[model samples]
Target: MTMSDDIVRMARAWIGTPYQHQASVKGVACDCLGLIRGIWRERHGTEPETPPPYTADWGEGGGQEVLMTAALCHLMPIDRQTPMEPGEVLLFRMRPGAVAKHLGILSAAGQAPRFIHAYNAHGVIDSPLTTPWQSRIAARFHFP
Candidate 1:
């Protein structure tokens, strides 16, 4: 199977994992970034590095591009203008002028696109990439 397909399959396997900040264990608990880190482990063996402890307002408080910076360091950065495709990692800003902090793995691309993410209080779910959500996308990357 292609690497993108492998990523989608692995990400889907984490479905139902509860959201737990700073945790990356599949099925047990994981936050948005945790979900990405877990997938990285599954696809590429060891993680490049472990993330430091972070609060809910981690990037917001510091105005640091923590998530985007790490992603650029480990993943293959993709042009934001390029059409999003299945298995791509999506970085979201969450709000205007905020650092890109949220992450999700695109599961389907074309029309009615969907992505899987660990939503707080809701666990991991494949959510529709609705217009509102689309507008929040700040960057995209492919697993290296």
Candidate 2:
């Protein structure tokens, strides 16, 4: 299968996985970052680097773009203006002045684009990439 297809497939497999901070095993639990980390491990044997623990609020207001920096270091950068497609990594800023911290993997694209993420109360699920979600996207990337 194509890499994009593989990524979507793997992400789908994590559907129903409970959201748990710092966890990464599929079907058990994972946070948004953990979901990305798990998929990376599926394609690459080792993680580029281990992440330090993050708080429930995602360490917001820290004045540091931690997530963006990490994505730049590992994933291939994609212009935020570029249309999103399956397998693309999405980094979001929860609020206007807050640090960009959320992450998701595009699962579908076109008229009704969708993404997979380990949401706090929703677990790992594919959801529509609605306007609000689109607006919060601070950057995009793809597996290196």
Best by lDDT: 1
- Kindly list the per-residue Cα lDDT of model 1 for residues 20-97, writing each as its tens digit: 988899989999999999999987799999888888775688798888888889989998778888999999988899
- Top-scoring candidate (TM-score): 1
Error of 2 at 24 (Å): 0.8
Off by over 4 Å in 1: none
| Model 1 clash number | 0
User: How do the residues 83-128 of candidate 2 rate in per-residue lDDT, one tens digit apiece?
Assistant: 7789998999988888888899999999999999999878999999
lDDT of 1 at 2: 90
Measured with C-alpha atoms, the lDDT of residue 108 in candidate 1 is 98
lDDT of 2 at 138: 87
